[model samples]
Target chain A: MFDMEPEVLERFTWYMREQSALTIMFHTKVAEQMGLSATDEKCLDLAMRADGPLTAGRIAELSGLSTGAVTGVIDRLERAGFVRRVRDPHDRRKVLVEVTAGDLAKFAHLFEKAQQSLVQVLSRFDPDEIEVIERYLQLQIETFRKAVINT
Target chain B: MFDMEPEVLERFTWYMREQSALTIMFHTKVAEQMGLSATDEKCLDLAMRADGPLTAGRIAELSGLSTGAVTGVIDRLERAGFVRRVRDPHDRRKVLVEVTAGDLAKFAHLFEKAQQSLVQVLSRFDPDEIEVIERYLQLQIETFRKAVINT
Candidate 1:
């Protein structure tokens, strides 16, 4: 017997696309407000999401962007004063990229607004449903990573 | 009583951000594969997703892009042979945009491949789990639409 129904798969794909579209719209709005390009916003986002200062290679890997592409992103971000490149003490050849405090402060309100909006939108779901969705998203992310590896 | 737990809300926000990252990656991959920019791939995708020739205003509205941005995207797509603009016979002030047959064929294969990959990834869930996820996503999309309207 099939583990999953066909309609389920269909809906999942539909949801993914719809979610993708919403995200694009949100980012465009935020970027326009910040006077930043989409890519520049992404670079800043990646830097902010990092646990600590990250190398360009690591950012590229996490972002599924090419190393060369990440280099350009870093260059642009650094030039915009959103991020800085600090030489790694342990590895002379490695440059750690960090999001500036100013950038974080600048985007703080936008992030807060987005969070509030999302929280309101999701206020209808119960804990169990939210758990299921979270698990499904985790699986989706893992699956994407595996696909990239296999490819 | 609150329907959502705090953790659930936090997870939902994280999921949204993760979904956003994945979309940017997917768009970048598609663009690179077609030797196009992200905007170009989006223009093609928008054209393909449309039921028929769409006006510039309609495309901009549906794409969550500004009219000027849509015009630029159309120019790039036209130059790349992916789309053409047809002036509305009844309304000279309006132009209708359509995907070229070659572009349609190309995007058909691409869409199929993406669907297959997504379906494979979703194959891990049981039937009930899949339905739950789908229902949850449907609700989320509806909620997002409401939020956008309210905003």
Candidate 2:
């Protein structure tokens, strides 16, 4: 690590705080647009990000919700068509929460706008600069993940 | 604007999604550590980010909650000592939601850990590279704000 001025660190801290706040606000907007509660949208997002549909208990564990609460969350999400409950074929007794892409299409425009914003931001940088920014993001996420776990 | 390959754009899109998801998870942990619900934490976050205290109506508008719902939110936050409702000095009838920093200090260590992670990430880059990263962050946030509003 190289030496840096205190002022620079302070400014970077502000930037990080600003970004975090904006991220949550953007999510709130997404939840509102989809007519879902923040909790429900969070569960659906978890399902979408997972490699496969998550079991009810797995979502409960990851979301820090009780089994009963996860059941209610799944019910609400399924009723809204954001997610569906499917019997896990490998274990017929287990149920999985699957995101419904068809229903999610309704919110595509909102995401597409965000994508456009990203594309526009990237357009400003050259390949080398983009590579640098990408590395920064990758490292930041990985470090934060470890930090969150340790916390 | 510079042109980029489709695959490159796709990779960046995945990175963006990853970052956004991790942000929400980190927020969940923060709320849990602070003994606040996600909704209450969100409102407190809004109050913290604002230039000054926000009126109950403004919080409702920003949070997309009804006035009655906001009243409940304020009550919970105040009871938890995360925020307080203060009479607006200029307008006696108006009440403003103020984030109580003294109460928030209980969770300062969590934020400090996040800050340390950010510093560690930035330390990986030299000053010039750090400048590029900062510029990218600033531009991305500004563009996203415009896009979110236009949508």
Q: Top model by TM-score, which number?
A: 2
- Measured by lDDT, the strongest candidate is 2
Q: Which lDDT value does model 1 have at A130?
A: 61
lDDT of 2 by residue, A1-151 (tens): 8778898888888887777777888888888888988788888888998998899999998888899999999999999888888999889989988888998887788799898889989999999999999899899989988988788
Worst 10 residues of 1 chain B by lDDT: B142-151
Per-residue lDDT tens digits for candidate 1, residues B45-148, read: 76766688889999887767789998998998888788899999999999899878865566555456567667876766666766677776776777665555
The estimated TM-scores of all candidates read: 0.81, 0.92
Under the 3 Å rule for N, CA and C atoms, how many clashes does model 1 have? Answer: 0
User: lDDT per residue, candidate 1, A75-130, as tens digits?
Assistant: 88888788899999999899899778875586667667667666765665566756
